[model samples]
Target chain A: MTTKDIGPKNPVEQGVTQVVDFVDERSGVKNSGRWLMFRNIPAGTSWFQTLGFTAMALFGMQAITGIILAMYYKPDPNTAFGSIAHITNEVTWGWMVRGMHKWGASVMIVIVFLHMGRVFIWGAYKYPRELTWVTGAMLLLMTMFMGLTGYLLVWDQKAYWATVVAVNIFASAPILGPYIGDILRAGPEFGPDTLSRFYSIHMLLIPGGIATFIGLHLYFIIRLGISEPPWAKRALRVQRDEEDARRKAARNREAGLKGSVSFPPAWVDDEQEVKR
Target chain B: MKKADKVAYDKDYAAAKKDGKPFFPYAIYKDTIIAGLAILVVIVLAITVRVEMGEPVNPASTDFLPRPDWYFYFAFELLKIFANQNALTPVIMATFMVPNILIILLVIWPFIDRGPERRIWKRPFAMGTAVLVISGLCYLTFLGASTPEGIAKGETLPLTGLDAAASAGEAVYLANGCSSCHMIKGVGAPGPGPELTNEGAKGWDNAKMVQWMKVPVAPMPSFASLPPEDLENLSTFLNGLGTKYK
Candidate 1:
C-alpha cells in the first residue's frame, strides 16, 4: 500500500479502478465518464499537451486581465477617457495590467485563429470533430465581439467615431442590419446607454457564452483526443520501434544495459507498443 | 463487426477508468473557489466605479461651430470644394461617383480576391489595394481638415452711398426677411442666405444684386416681396458690411 511499492505499476489499470470506484460511490450515470457508457478503449494518453492547452492558457490570461481592467473602467463617455488616463498614470501597475489586457485581447484573437488553423490543416474538422470546430468558430466570433465591445468602453473621440462608422457599416447589411444596429446601439443614438449596454455584454453576457462554449469544447477535445498529423500513419510504425528501443534502453540503463529481458517479455513490450 | 465491437468496448472501458477520478486532486473545491473569487471581484469593481456625465447637448447654437467628427471631415471638406463652380473641373468625379465606385469595389473585394492564402506577404494585391485606398482617404481627409471657413475668391458687389444706405439697409434687412437667408457676423436664422459681410465688395454690380434679390436662383431663395427701395437698401447694407475685406 506504500507509495514506493506501487511505483511504476500499471497506471492505466489503477486509473480505471479508481473511476469504477468513483462511479460506485456516486451512483449516477450523469457523473460517469463516457468510457463507462461506451466501454473498451485504451487510456493514459497525454492528449491535452497541444495547441488546445495553449488556447486555454491564453483564455486564463484574458480572464485575469479583464477582471483587473473592470476594476477601474467606467463606461460613461465623459469620464471614460479621464478614467483610462488615471489608470495609466495614477494606479499602481495599472498601466502594465491594462497594456497586457489590451495586447492580450489581440493575442487571444491571434492564438485562437492559429489554434483553429492547426485544426483545419490537420483535417480534425472532417468527421466527429466537426462540432468541436463549430464551437471553436463560435468562440472566435465571441472573442472578436468582446474585443469590439471593450474598445467602445474607452469612449474617446476615436472610439466614438470609429463605432459610428462601424455601426453605419452594420446598417448597410440589408433590412435587418438597421434593426440590429439600432438594438446594438440600444436606441436611436450612440450615447451613454449604448456604452452601458456594450459594457454589460463585454463583461457578463459574452463571457457567459464563451464559458459555455469552452466547457463543450473541452469535453469534445478530451473525448476525441488530439488528432494525429497526417505523418502519424508512417510515424506510428517507427514510433513503436522507437518505443521498444527506448524501453530496452531504459531497462538496460536501470540494470546497466548488460542486463537482458527474456524474449517473451520483450515480445509483450513490442505488442503493447503496436497496440498504442 | 464483432471484432470492431470488442475493440471499441475495450477502448471505452479503458477510457472510463482513465477518466473516473477528478483530473486534479482538488478539482471541485479549486474550481468553485476560483469562480467565486472572480465573480466577487467583478461585482465589487462594478459597484465601486464612478461614472460622470458631461454637459447636455444643444444643436441650435452658432458659436459651437458645427464640424463633422474628424473621420468624416474629409468628406465634409470634399462636399464644400465640389460645391464650387469652376473650369477644368469634374465635381461629380470627386464627390459622388468616385466615392460610390470605391465603396462598390470594397463591397465586392472578398469575392474578387478569394485566394485561400491569408498571409499579408502572399496577398500583395489585397494589401496594396487597402494601403492605396487608405492613403488616398487620409490625404483627402487631411486636405478637408485644413480648409478654412470663409468666402470664395474673385467675388464682389458694388455699394453706392453706403453711409446713409447702411442704416436704411439694416432696417430693410430685418423687415424683408434678409436675416432669414443670410448670416451677419455669425448670428442669424439657419437658411441658404448668403453671408452679408463684405458682400458688395465682391465685384457684383447694383443691377445684378437687384436682379438676384428680385428672383433667387439655384441655392438662393427669392426676395420678390421686397420693393425696389427695400432691395436697394438691403443690397446697400450687404455691400457696406464687407468693406473691411475689400
Candidate 2:
C-alpha cells in the first residue's frame, strides 16, 4: 500500500505531479485544500456538518434543473401554463428536471433548517460566528422567498391562487401594505404582466440573493472552521490560565523582579547585565 | 491546555495519524465520489418521476380552492383561523410576524446564549427555545396541511410602546375582549361605540378617564371591576396613543 514501495512511478503520474507543482507554486491552491481537509474539527461532528454540504449540493441540483426548465418556460400567462405542460410531456427529460427542482426546493429548506437546529443546539453561533448565523438567516429568508416566487411561475390554478393568497398576506401589512402587494402582484390583479415579473424575480433576483448570502455564510464557516460540541470531555480553560500565570510568576522571581518595581532600576537590564 | 494535556493530545494525534494519508488524495477522493453519487441519485430520479401540472388559472371560475404548496400549509391553517373574523390579521400573525420573530430569534440567539456550554442539557434556555420553535412550526404545518386554504385577512393592532405598563394594559384590553366592541387603530370588529384610538386627545386626564370608566356614557358599559392601578395604566396607554399618533 505504500506509494514509494510501488514499482516505478509511471510517466503519467510524473507529468501530473509536474503540472500540480506548477499550478500550486503560483496559486498555493494545494495549501488551501490541505487546510480545508486537514483542519482540526471537533470529534463527533460528522452528521450535522453533512447536512450543510448536502443542502449546498441540493442547491446545485436545483440551479441546474431550474436553468433547464427556464429554457422552455414562457412568461406569458396565456402560454406559461402551456409551456410547463409542453416541458413535462414534450421536452426530453424535462419532467425529471422540473420534478427534481420542485422537490429540491422543499428538501433544501428542510435540510437547511435542520442544519441550523444543529448549529443552535451546539451553541456554535456564539460571538465569533455571529456573522455566519446572520448570513445563514438571510439565506433562509431568501430561499423561502424563492420558493414563493417560483411557485407562482407555473401560472396554473393552484399556483395562481396560492400566489394570490401570498400577495394578499403581504398586502395586509399595516403600512405600505398595498404597495408591497402591488410589487408582488405587479398590479391590482394577477394578469399577463404579473407572470413575467415573477419569472424574473424567481429566476434571477431571489436565486441571486440566496447565492450571495450562502457565499458569505460559507466564507465565514471556512474561516472559523467547525465548532466543538461542549459535551466532549474538553480540558478546563481556567486550569490552563492558572498554569500560565504560575509559570509567569516563577519566571519573574527567577529574574529577581518579584514585587520590586520603582519605575525602571529594579527591572532594567537584568538579563544583559548593563550598568545603570 | 496544561503541558501534560498538551503532551497527551500530541501522542493521541500521532497515534491516530500513524497510517493516515494527506487530505489531497484521501479526503478529496472521498468527497468527489460522494458528489458523483449524489448526481447519480438526481439523474435516476429525473429519469423516472416528472413534475406535475394543473389546469391554467381562470379568475372567472371560483370553484377550485387555491391552496399553497405543502411547505406553506401551516400558514394556510393560520389564514383559516382568522378567516372572515374581520377582527384580526391572521396573515401578519401567522405568515409575517411569526416567521420574522423566529428569524430574529435565530439571529440574536448567539448573543442571548453567550455561555460556552453547548451540551443540550447544559444550555436549557437555548435548547428549550429551539425545541419550542421547531415543534410549534411542525405542529402548525401539520394543521395547515389538513385544513383547506382561504384568503389571508389582516387586522391592525397599533399598540406601539413596549413598556411593561403599556403592554400590560394592551393585554388587559385584548384579554377583556374590548376589541369585540370598541375598535383601536382600525383593529377589532366595527362596534356601535366610538373609536378609542384618540381618547387622550379629548383633554381628559387619567383621573377623568378612570372616573368616566366607572360611571359611563350610554351604550358604554362601566368596567367597574377594573383595579385602580390598571385603570391608571390603561388611561396612560390611551393618552400615549393619542399623542404618538398625532
Candidate 3:
C-alpha cells in the first residue's frame, strides 16, 4: 500500500530484503533462532573476543585524547614543552588524558603483540591469511614508529637526549647512515626544526598511512570471514550433508517420489546449513 | 549389495553434490556495524582533543649543564668513562656499533629462531638471550645514572704537600703533555681527552686521585715513576684547583 504498491517494491527495500533472505536462505539456522541470539551479542565469545574489544576501546580513548593534545601542542621546538606544561596545569583533566594516552600506547603495543601471538599459535597465518599476517607486522612497526616520533615531539630533556642517542645510533649505519640520521633530525643537529618535522610526521603522516593500511587490513579480514577450527569445519560439513538429505526427503515426502526435485533445490538447504 | 542399488546410490551422490550451497553468504550488516563504530570513534576523537605547547629553546647559556635526556644518560655517562684519548676511539666504536648490530640481529630473529615450537618454555635459548641482553642494558643504564661526573680526572691528580697545590697541579699538568691532548678552561686545543677544569669539584678525593694516577691503563700512561710526594703534590694541586679556578 505504501511504496510497495507503486512498484513491485522499492529497490532499496527489496535489496535489503534480498540480502536478509539470502543470508537466511543460505544459512539453515533461522534468524530468530536461539543460537543466533547468542552469536549476535558482543562478549559472547571467550577471552580473545574480550581482548579485541578492549583494544578497540583503548584505541578510541587514544584518538580522543590525542585530538585534545593536538589542539594545544606547538610543533615548534621553542614552545613545545611550555605548551605541554600549560595543558597539564591549566586544562581540566588534561593530565588524565595525557596519562591515559601514554599508558594506552603501552597497552596497545602489548595487545598487538598478544594478538599476533594468538594468530601465530592458531596457524591463522597459513595460506589465505598470509597477507593479513604481513599487514599486521607492518601495522606493528608503524605503531612503534608513531610512538617514537610522538616521543620526540614532546621536546623535553628526556625527548632531546633520547633523540640524540637514537640519531647517533642511526648514524652508525655503514653507508648512508649519517645522511639518514641528518634527515631524521631535519638538520645536522636536534633543534626546533627537528621537533617540528617529527611533530608533523607524528600527527599527520604516520596516522594517515596507518589508517589507510588498517582499511585494507580490515577489508581482507572481513573477506576471509572468521576462520573456523578444523574440528568445527568437519562438523559443519557433516551437518550440511545431513541437512541436504533431510530437505530432499521432505520434498519427496511432499510430492510423490516419482516427481523428484533436482539436487539444486536441496543444495539451497546445504548452503543454509553451512551458513548456520 | 545389488548392482542396481549401488548404481542408484552413486547417481544420488553425484546429484547431491550438485545441490550443495554456495561457499559464502551476504551477512554484511553485522561486520558493517562494527567497522562503522570503530571509524566513528576515531573520527570523533580526532576532532575534539587538543595538544599543548612548551617554551622556546635557547642555545647560548653556559649554565645549562647541557645534559642529554635520561634515556641517553648511559651513553653520555659512557662518554665520561672513556674521557682519555687512548680509550676514546674504542669506546666511541663500541657504544655506537654494538647496539646497532644487536638491533639488526633482533629484526632477523624470527627467521633465525625458526623452530616449530612457540612456547616460551620451549624456546630457552632465545628467551635466555633476550633476558640477558635486556638485563645487561638495564645494568649499564643504572650504572651510568649513579656514577658522578669528573670523578675520573680527579682520581689521577698528585697530592704532595704544596700550599699552592692548584697552581702546582697546573704546572705538573703542562709538564706532562696532558695539555697536548686535553683542554682546561677552554684554553687548550681540542684533542682526544675530556676537559679537566672541574675534575675535583665534581666528586674526587685525594686518595682516589693518587691511586688512579699511579697505575693508569690504555689511554692515560701510568705515572708510577713519579715520586709519591710529587704525586701527592699534584693531587693536592688538582683538588685545590677545583675551588680556585671556579
Residue pairs in clash, model 2: B89-B154, B89-B155
Which candidate has the top score in lDDT?
2
**Model 3 segments more than 4 A misplaced:** A1-46, A49-57, A228-276, B1-246
TM-score of each: 0.44, 0.64, 0.48
The TM-score that candidate 2 achieves is 0.64
Which has the better TM-score: candidate 1, or candidate 2?
Answer: 2
Report lDDT per candidate.
0.55, 0.66, 0.55
Clashes of each: 26, 2, 45
lDDT of 2: 0.66
Q: What is the TM-score of chain A in candidate 2?
A: 0.76
- State the lDDT at B28 in candidate 3: 31
Q: What does candidate 3's lDDT look like per residue over A69-125, in tens digits?
A: 998888876677788787777878776667667656666666665665555544445
Q: Model 1: runs farther than 4 Å from truth? A: A1-49, A234-276, B1-246
lDDT of 2 at A4: 66
lDDT of 1 by residue, A1-276 (tens): 654555336899888877877877878654565443343222232232244555666667778878988889877756667777777678887766666666556556655656655554444453345567767777877886787777666665445544554454454454576697788889855656888888898889999999999999988866764444433332333234445677777877788655565434333443354355
lDDT of 1 at A104: 59
